[model samples]
Target chain A: MSAFNAQRITAMQWLSRQLLNQDVAGRYFDPLIEPLNPRWALGRMIATVERIEDETHDTRTFVLRPPRRWRGFLAGQHVTLALDINGVRHHRTFSLACAPETWQREGLIRITIKRTPEGLVTPWMHKNLYRGGALEISEAFGNFLLPDVEAPLLYIAGGSGITPILSHLESLACREYTAPITLIYCIRSAQDQIGAQQLEQLQHKLPLLNCQIIRADQGEGQPPRLLQASDIDSIKNIQARHCYLCGPTGLMAVATTLLETRDVPEEQVFQTFFAPLTNPLTDTAGGAVTLMRSNRELTVDSGQSLLEAAESAGLSPRFGCRMGICHQCSCRKTTGTVVNRNTGHVSGPGEETIQLCVSVPQGPVSLDL
Target chain B: MKTLNETQLQRLETGLDAIREDVVSDLGERDARYIRRIIRLQRSLEVAGRILIPLSLTPVGFVAGTASLSLAKIIENMEIGHNVMHGQYDWMNDPALYSQDYEWDTACDSNSWRRTHNYEHHTYTNIIGKDRDYGYGLLRLSNDTPWRWRNLFQFADYVGLSVLFQWGVGLHELEYEKLLSGEISLRDKGGFLKEFFRKGGRQFFKDYVFFPLLTFPVAGKVLLGNLSANLARNLWASTIIFCGHFTEQAATFHEADCENESKGQWYYRQLTGSSNFTGGRWLHLLSGHLSYQIEHHLFPDIPAHRYPEMAPRVQALCKDLGIPYNTGSFGRQYATVVKRILRFSLPERLTRQAA
Candidate 1:
């Protein structure tokens, strides 16, 4: 409150408490004047799943409406979404598989998620995520975008790598782009190709779009259905096009090698992986250690975060916003040094509050959990 | 640039890093308890003060009610609001104290404050043309700011700003200057205006219209009490903030001078750009631990309660490095701030001695 009219403010608050009820008034009024929803005060952007659509046997597209606090994102950007299941919050990055235009017009963005057999979050999302479910989303970020130049484009997508490419195609189709574009999507079989309907719709809308699906298991005729350098060489004007490859690591490597052999410049070929990037700290020398927290004692891998090690040991800890920003995973570091994965800043060897998600154990570190 | 040798820069970096690591390691349950307790105390005082307002027909009731209300507002704005919004105590993971979600009780929208204060002000510190808090584009705080004829009325503007600080803050990000220069149209500011009106309306109705009408026949007494308490809070807030920032010893910088600023140079800038004042524990709390502004600037995200403990160590480091640690008594620092304000009220060209 400013010096101007301070008294009336006090009386008004008093009256509000006496009349409308304090919590009720605050709930109804504060959000009107504030950006965050007071009810879900998790210090992160919250989005509600408005609808869900299964794209394939293993892939589903979730349409989410984020709160007004969200600043929105560009086409082909990925967002880190977190969901708490059984009190343990898990976070993963998913590409926005819908056009940015849709978000502006209808206030919705979609992410097509393919469940990895070993993944914790995706499998749960496939089973438990329903319409009207609320999940925490980070602001969208990533630089894998179409170049401004009107060059002919060749996109090679293997398995779930087609998500971001789908977003680019949808956005471009909406913008009435004139550049010739070709997508060769490889899956185990035709049944596993996600967003087939959407791709067909986009192809029908754009005159310059050419999409083809390659099913490895359906190669019953002349040749094997693996992407080869000769296969890319056969495409008209393949040498003049910019190549974008995304998918499993093996496919990416093969495509990159093929593209490079054809004299494609490094900058002309772009790639993005949805899998977790290998932690650089894992290469650092750290002694194997025991983590003692609450009633659990478990052996932890050197150079791995206490949170990850704890999860590996089957411990469920309360957490929110897995990034260090939220600090929901902060626990007492009572006895040893740890390196912050985000900043590479080392902690002092003493009792201190350390964010569990980002702090990699330097040695045998003891956490209060 | 202050021309420090490589050895000196390295030494400063090491010292500052050690201090940060030590303090961060020291954070524990006690710090969490301190902030949580402060929130509870502030809410309790506010509730008590508001409840006491209707009894203002009696002299003692008026005194107690206004005083309690002012105390609550002070704690909320300074300790609870400012500190929480700084990302301090964010490690607690308590939803109520989460920096991004916390909305302050002021005229300024919390999002705007985060942009202007948390991101820009803290990142740039006292760098000229960058740090908006350096006179807030109204006054000429440094000689680097070209003397404009309009600055002659800055003293009046500053006074008006203090009286309605929250309003000034709310309007800070609107860029009225650009709007006046015809760079942007009303249509461009439509969204901003809508937000401003929404937030400003709530503040106005609560303070001026709603409560006064609630008191009925004795509405005048309640209105007067609320007015006095607000004025008291504004005056104190202005005084403490000015003392920490504008005292004679606080240095200002050119943006060019801060280019490629090393971690050591960053620490040096924070030390030179902020002034501190001595006070008791209560005064420290009331000031939102801003009394140790040097410490606050050095470690903006650390809990303010730790500033007192970190101050002596930082001061010692400054002494060893031969850097001037600017600090003084509350009276002396505040007097120096007022002197600067008055001195810079007129254009420097006009204020120059006869040559």
Candidate 2:
């Protein structure tokens, strides 16, 4: 923490980068160090699981103790957790459910994950990951940040979406900010609600905090009570408050429309999506794809990304993140047009690098796979 | 030899495709853990070897150090480096195991290996004048090519080639035949030569200069240990590779005959042109699973460890299709490889007359 120590650390980092480049150093040292301590890595940020707490039957909270050099995240930011299960590395982004102050003071963070029965990673994490397990985590990212101004805050969360909102509330409580705050927590049933105790503590800490736990599934055969305009209209000065939304697409869409009809300023609205947005090309029939390296040709449907198509065709191409955040799956395309599912940008009919996870061929395409 | 009709070829293709799909889908944590464990074991051996060679006070210490180091280098080159560079573990998405990003502890650069070995040799298997891997342009292995007088003394060249196999592979992509024939000038190979030297220089420095100097008091001993280890690794790797393709039963194809081959025909060519050496797990592991040379040629991108399991299925298919599945004991295979080399040392007419 001292100036001299800081300068020395920077100089050492520079020297190590020059003398022991990551590719070379990592390949040699990682295998050696990993056996002694799985958390130790030369080029990756690895965190050890401190504790595991089950918040609900299907939801669990993992308290992680990251390494010293891990740059902390904003209160509502998310980090990508890389888990090597069954020998293949799988990546998923989860919101940092703990306050930033907690990370700075305790050097620990928490991520609350909801188990999806049909999903690959969540169920594995729930069943296998244990205390003292090491996980690779990327630095905190996402734009669901707190506003600098002293404005009334409105947070709307649906089911597991309460993670980032919990961070925001806890962060605000740590700062002793007493500005008016309203939170609408929606879940299917009472047992499905997460952070109930934390919400109570937060409400007690901030006098103006008003919390509402809404249940969408009333009972069998009863129509589901979704987010209605009355939920927003009940809040005082709802139009003037800065809104943060995190939830399923349907709930977020309804909330956004309600806010828009109320004439809330668009800039004041902040939202984050837990899942990758649906690609526009999902319904179109794909074209022929030629894997030039293997001298194989297959037809891939537009519903699947090139990476998925390749894997299903019994060809394994290099890939990472699988969500277009990492450029690991980028391969050169020799000919044909494609659309980037992330940005919906069409590429020219020329040689160019395209991310296999997000690229869908618009027509007959040839790749250097 | 048996030739298949169109329907039979299609059936063969479908059968092989099913086998590949079964293994590809089953790839997961087990395969990942196996490779990682091998890497760890290799590095541990290397570290122990480096330390023991310099610090030991007896000849046993030196021998142990040299053997350990030699085994480490062999594993790094065969099981780990060769298979990883062939994109066997590419699905893991681990940066260290990535084919494009990996650099092996040998004189040969990974890029050159990927080009010449992965793309060229693999694509053109044992096609004469196409796959440079067949005999590595040093010795005659089959009668497909015209005999040259220089081949008479190629038995000695084989010994020299085995002793310095790493360097031979490092210089393989340069096409020395073209250089000798004035088809390509030294300037045309400037970039390749630079990469070859840079990679080769680092390897030499590590084994001979840097590690030896670390223990200056016994620098000579350490240098000798490193030299012996590298030589042992070179010979082992060369022998394993030769037994894969140059055995007596392994066939060779002409470019004209292989042109426009279908998937089934291509698989058939690979099956006939490569021979497998039966061995225990350790022998197979040390050879980087190249012992299952027939399966490796057919499914080059699959993890080599899986080849043991795949070999039985492939052999069954070969039997069903009535195609030759060449295999034998390691000693028998090596003897046959030597026989093929010696038999081809003379002109085809003279060898046939002698037979």
Candidate 3:
């Protein structure tokens, strides 16, 4: 097992398995029956709205409107955002805030997008999209939403994990539900938080609802004590509640441990990983370019990475998290070498040049795409 | 009486009446005591077909092996469960004298399947007014061609995947229905309806897709053998039941007149409606008493176990009386049923010549 793969398995566990699927159908007809379905191209983009809330520096939450006919999804469920940067199309999955039924009823869909240091699709969307713009979104998909069990909910969210958790609260609150509900949302510094006003409105609206917004940016308030198990104990019984948490990489792991140590049923606590993979090309002053995706070789330009060279040669490869973290772009190097910009180390020394998101092929390479 | 042109078959009504009387007279014999023995032999052929099949174990890395094994299990179970439940072994006892198929709730009592199925489907065979197996949704499940539908302009039964599910909806309801005529206590009604829907959904899916998908072979592996076997169970299960009522030669009358249809007329209907599949006595036992559906439908009270001997006696009686008695090997009889379907589904001029 690769260190990149998560140890915990699930009912539909195949979704999280990092697979490098190239658009390989154009070459030969597939005669054998396989469960692996291919990625379809983004056809005409339906007209949509992008309501933005400006935070500091370039980060913000872009509330995207899904096509009206496209309804029915749980919060934390993300759509793969289709982008055409420099005429190159790619997809990225983002979690939607609020329950599917809410957007279904209100004629709106909301996505809380944060601008990374160099987000390819995010920067493009923040600049171009306005009300009634073409918002190219994929079909709503994901199984990470809160399960419809009878357990009381124990919500532990960090960063954007709060989106699905908030959707869960909104759904349960509407039924005037009899089940127990608790929410813990963690954010970096108070200003980066967007949904505090919505949470405040929900607190005053529902009688049995409890909301806690914890800040991790300890300046004057000690970041509200980092949402421990004891904090949830003060609110309601934890034994009979379903816990759903989503957020930063470190907080997600710690929350998973806290709940397990607290003896919450493993099935009851759910986590949605926000760590996505996308590639941002940087100049490598081409010594020699090796594209190791099949024996399919390509030249790496001083300006473009191995992916760009392949795309320029009319080979459109699939990628989700262009960052090396998501492993979506990892290809095998039958032979050759590549340099990783993040670690500044050459991986193809004794091995082959794998598509390490931000890596460029150093020499002649063969890839098993 | 009109005689079929192609064969030695004669519509000898008087001869049929005499043969019917002769069958009852011969009933004093050990094998013929119960009127249903002839049909039991047919079911026995189907019963014997279910041999001890070896299980195939699959490797863990792939899901291929597990699916095929499950399919084998489905084939075996569907045949055994259906035949055993149907009381194809006619000697089995029924506690009451009743026929029921009103989607009812009787959680209070549980011993009603024997009466509803063992008595009704066996006695009435494919009579829509009585046989629980008969379904009337857009797609009809059973084989018997309804006189009313035949007289009508449009098709009541559709074919293919989409229509198969809708027609099968009623068959699935059979698993939960209380089908009894006792006092409807509130508790019984409540318990029955609640459990019915909860469990009913599974049966609906199982029949519609799970069963079919399970038997579907994975790639590279040829499945026509297993396919043949699975289909054998299915075709055997429904066809035997259908043969007793759907054959072009089968007779029907208004339910009001079922009681008045002369004993010979009833026998004639059973003879024409049902068929005999000759050869392989061992095949008869394993497959349950399906091949002898004609004899079983004629006498529902007879135990199916005795049909092997009774079938030969019935055939002889028909021969002696100079009346046409339908008897064909399994393959031929299967072809006949298929022909009857074509006769029903196709245009009149292209299919069976109307009487």
Which is the leading candidate under TM-score?
A: 2
TM-score of each: 0.53, 0.91, 0.36
Quote the RMSD, in angstroms, for model 1: 18.3
Tens-place lDDT digits, model 1, residues A3-57: 5577776776665544322323453233232333422533356788989998888
Instruction: Please give the TM-score of chain B in predicted model 3.
Output: 0.51
What DockQ class does candidate 1 belong to? incorrect
User: Which residue runs does candidate 1 get wrong by more than 4 Å?
Assistant: A1-318, A321-369, B349-355
Interface RMSD of 3: 32.5
* Chain A TM-score by candidate, in order: 0.70, 0.86, 0.64
DockQ per candidate, 2 decimals: 0.02, 0.54, 0.00
Q: lDDT of model 1 at residue A257?
A: 93
* Candidate 3: tens digits of C-alpha lDDT, residues A147-184: 65555677778776676666766666566666666777
Identify the superior model by TM-score, candidate 1 or candidate 2: 2
What digit string (tens of lDDT, one per residue) describes model 3 on residues B219-321? 2221422334433334344555444444555544335545655545555555655666766854565445666776666654444555665676677766865
lDDT against the true structure, per candidate, is 0.78, 0.88, 0.50
Best by DockQ: 2
Show the lowest summed lDDT stretch of 10 residues, model 3 chain B. B95-104
- Identify the runs in model 3 with alpha carbons over 4 angstroms from their true place: A1-47, A54-59, A68-71, A218-225, A232-235, A276-316, A323-368, B1-355
DockQ score of the complex predicted as candidate 3: 0.00
Better by TM-score, candidate 3 or 1: 1
